[model samples]
Target: MTASTDLLATFVARYPAQPATAFWRGIEIEQLARAFASDGVGLDLGCGDGILTDILFKRIGVTPRLIGVDIDPLETEAAAAYSFYDRIHTIPAQAIPEPDASIDYVISNSVLEHIPDLEGVIAEVGRLLKPGGRFYFTVPAPGFHRNLRGSILPGVSRERYLADLDKRLAHFHYLSAADWRAMSARHGLALDSATGYLDGKETRRWEHLSRMTGGLLHSLSFGKSRPIEIQRALRIRDLQNRMALPAPVASGIAKMIACPDAPDSDDIQSCLLVTGHRPRD
Candidate 1:
């Protein structure tokens, strides 16, 4: 199997109950793995449960000096199981415990959009990074809402549906690449690259799968901060964790979820992979 296929298979096997998340994350992890530095003192911003980071490190086949941080203690408690991170801190993004210029890189995967205090977090990123330190993150584009299949559903108002969808996802920002560049510039992080990924069709498929895979129900019952809490309350994640599919069945399902779009596609993109760096001087 190709590397991309292998990644998808891994996620599918691990997250049999969250196939939509696994599918989307498989694509995302492949992109991150390709660019992530194998050596350095790195921080994983908003690293949830450390599952994705664990998978990423396994794929990269390295044990770098990495730290995981998140606001959710439950998630961090779960994250503590991963040996990949040197330390795990449960803290708000704006007040990371590390000293200034202490980190060689920071990665926040699909995380920044949910932060209302984005400027504060970016400012924190600027303060923590060493000279020439890199920052990598991914987020949905502004066009993501416009591309959703539900936006075009008969009898539904596109604006209302899109608005409700954003609220459901707890997304606060859908900035364009230019917007990211401008924001990074203000924070002293030079925009090295902003590449598009996950085209419109793939995005629509993702939306459909999310709803079909109980994501919509989770969204309805719990807000962004409540996912881990609710899951723990009901022990739903525990049950899901035990319900693994056979390898062949999981592979087939993963293939069905995988999109044909290259990790960085030029088509009307639904998401972005942005990279920037602090100036050496």
Candidate 2:
């Protein structure tokens, strides 16, 4: 095998999956490890289950003083298992458990899209970041719906498909570059950089496969929570972290993965990553 193929195979093997869905997203993030490097303290917002962040850092080979914050007690306990973060806090988005001007960097991965009050999160991110501190996040564009049209729901009405997705994913907004600039400006943050990833065709493939696998999981679990999701037990959580496999599924008109390796070429891409900073006056 050529060097690139060998690398890809190694990547795919290292980040194995049980449901085998969204495997591409992990590969995509690992490719952008350099951009995620941090110098001082760092925080992860909405750190669901924390497996992805753990896996990503392992790939990047950097273990900075990272703190994880999530609202779900289940997720916060799970976050401790990977031992990826130096500290993990369970709190609301409005209440980050950190002092002002203390954090050097913050990352919100695949999280901003699901929030109902986009402005509040932006405002709080501004509050937590130190001057010149950066926040890197990923959100899908408005055109994401196009991928869902024939891929996830064929013979279904547009209205129905959209409603189903919004309900299933609990999503509120999808933003373009213009939206990012406006929101960042309103929240006292400046756009440092941005890039998009996952083309329409590739996004459709990811979405289609995700739904199929999720359905299989739901049926297999029989609507009961899996024990490996042991929020009350740390030892079991750390040992069986593999249960966090398959990665969380995503549904939208557009799908985007966060990868700094991708070039900023297309506006109509599946996912966009925006790096914002608090500029000193």
Best by lDDT: 1
| TM-score of each model, in listed order | 0.89, 0.76
lDDT values for all models: 0.79, 0.63
Query: lDDT tens digits, residues 80-136, model 1?
Result: 877778998899999998999999999999999999999999999999999989998
Deviating ranges (above 4 Å) for candidate 1 = 1-3, 151-154, 215-230, 239-246, 260-266
**Per-residue C-alpha lDDT of model 2 across residues 1-281, encoded as one tens digit per residue:** 01123223333333333222344444346434646656688888888777667656766777767788888887787678765578888887877767888888888877888788778888888988899898888777776776553424458777776665565556688888888998999988999766766665556555655565543344355634332332224354344445422222321111232222333344466667778799886
Regions of model 2 farther than 4 Å from truth: 1-21, 31-34, 151-155, 215-267
Candidate 1: the clashing residue pairs are none
Q: Count the backbone clashes (under 3 Å) in each candidate.
A: 0, 6
